[model samples]
Target: MLKRYKKYSFLFQELVHRDFTKKYKRTALGIGWSVLSPLLQLLVMKIMLTKFFATGIEHYTTFLFAGNIVFNYYNESTSSGMTALAENSAIISKVNVPKYMFVFSKNISSLISFLLTVVVFFVLAALDGIEFTWKITMLIFPIVCLVLFNIGLGLVLSACYTFFRDLQYLYSIFTFLLMYMSAVFYDISAYSDFAQKLFLLNPIYLFIRYFRKIVMEQTIPTIWFHLLMILDVCIVMIGGFYMYKKYNHDFLYYF
Candidate 1:
């Protein structure tokens, strides 16, 4: 797969560049929106929810930042990637390039935005009096997992969207529900033990919890948590690759 990708490395780079540029084109703030948008969201959530949900929570702003950043990345990556094939139908129908490259390029563009937002997250954490600790470096683990997970998920969504246009509408509603379930602003501990455990079933919640553990609590997550993250990525990637392999040719017909 690496060799196949490398064979068209230039094309991949161009796709990534084009997508990134197109995202910010004619925008006043341009890339600054990546940093400002999440911070603005954090401020709004903090103001509205602090009295109700943030009780007993230390560094609540930082905690919300951790969750929001991760969730937003997944949401943006998957949403954009879902349209990769259909959006690029003109090019795909003409060129002999790998279809997955378009999906990957969309993901890469989202990732660049996510990374820009991380800088704001850390700065906010520092301002909130959260000390910088060695454990903070451990954020990379969950981030790497989320990136792979998003790529895998993007592939699946793009493939599915090619066939069933209704998925686009359904997924928007699902993402909204997912945002609330992810506990981005609320404290999951407010729920009963059984309910808390149930939230773990959400991969987005798991990734957010993992980030909070390292960023907010300054501790490493359990080995089982790490394993589960890897397992989730593998399951999605396997399923996504299978779909792409089976339906790559079929995508053109639908397009």
Candidate 2:
């Protein structure tokens, strides 16, 4: 796979550039929207849910921002990846490029936006009086895990979407439900102990919780927690790659 990627590295770069440019094209604020959009979301949640959901939480806005950045990245990457093949059908049909490259490019674009939002999140955290600690450097672990997980997930979703047009709509509804369940604005402690354990089953929530631990709590997550994240990424990648390998040929027909 590395050899294949290296041989087509130029094509990958082109696709990444095109996708990134297209995402912000014709927008007045352009890339500024990446930072501004999440901040605006934080503002709305802060105003509406603060009194109700943020009780006993210190630096609630920063907490919410941490969750939002991680979840938003996953949402954007998977959603864009779901349509990667269909959207690029014409090019794929004519060119010899790798099918997964299209999905990867979309993820790269989303990742760029995600990184921008994360920088803003840190700034917001400082503004909220959350002190930076060396422990914050540990966030790279979860960030790397989430990125790999998103890539694997994108591959699987793009493959499935090629065969099933209805998946897009269903996925939209699923993400809506996922957002509420992720505790993006609320404290998970408000829930019963069983419910808190159940929320841990959610990979998105797991990543969010990891980020909050490092940023808001100023603590490193346990080694067991790190192993759980690694396990989640491995499961998703193995399954996704298996699907892609098995169905790569079929994608041309669906497209």
Candidate 3:
């Protein structure tokens, strides 16, 4: 096998191109669907929940957009990453490319789409009369958190799905549940203090809350928030890398 960490740099361009082409192939409207899907969901959710949440949040649609962008990124990364390797079995058997490349490629694809959705969210937020402030720069930190967490998650899920084919379906259900549990559609602080503490333990909620604070509320993320995210990302990435490396060779047999 190629040396660990070497393959990411060597095969980066090829994997990115392959991932981009494969994603939009045979699809009508092509990449437009990426922007449309999240926007459509945001519209529907906003219309339905507006009456209930209208009291606290003046612009419910923008609130939904802020939260949905972060949630969609997490869901897409985890779901696609889980099946990335298994779906690329033909290439795996024929070439000597690193297995992690396939998983990383899927994540890159999802991140591209996520970035597109973020642009759309910003446009809608602007339309809603949300002013751009310097605090908007806080978005950069959460984006870095997203990348760090996703790379680690993609590695671990790709490795796990190699041994358990059923995991793909199970992961989908789990992701949906996680989405609701997160502060995606509603603010968790609205809950009791004990419930809020429990929710903060969820990394997904932490990512969303931080982004919403910066993008929608125009507030800077706290130092403690950045520190906690960094710690979480490091633990996940190191542990995931070790697991993926140990199981790298065995993945082909399952595929």
144-218 per-residue lDDT for model 1 (tens digits)? 999999999999999999999999999999999999999998787778999998998899999999988887888
Give the per-residue lDDT digits (tens) of candidate 3, residues 1-255. 345657457576677777877788999889998898998898898888777665687566787787788888888887888888888899898988777778788888888999898888889988998888988877888898888799898888888888988888898899889988886777665788999888877888889888778777788867987888888888888877998778878877777
Span of ten consecutive residues with least summed lDDT in model 3: 1-10
Global Cα RMSD, each model = 0.9, 1.0, 2.2
TM-score of candidate 3 to 2 decimals: 0.92
- Position 152, candidate 3: lDDT: 90
Model 1 is weakest, by summed lDDT over 10 consecutive residues, at 183-192
lDDT of 3 at 94: 90
Q: Which candidate is the best by lDDT?
A: 1
* C-alpha lDDT of all candidate models, in order: 0.92, 0.90, 0.82
Summing lDDT over every window of 10 consecutive residues in candidate 2, give the lowest-scoring window: 183-192
Off by over 4 Å in 2: none
Tell me the tens digit of each residue's lDDT in model 2 across 88-151: 9999999988889999999999999998888888888898999998998898999899989999
Cα-based lDDT at residue 117, candidate 2: 89
TM-score of each: 0.98, 0.98, 0.92
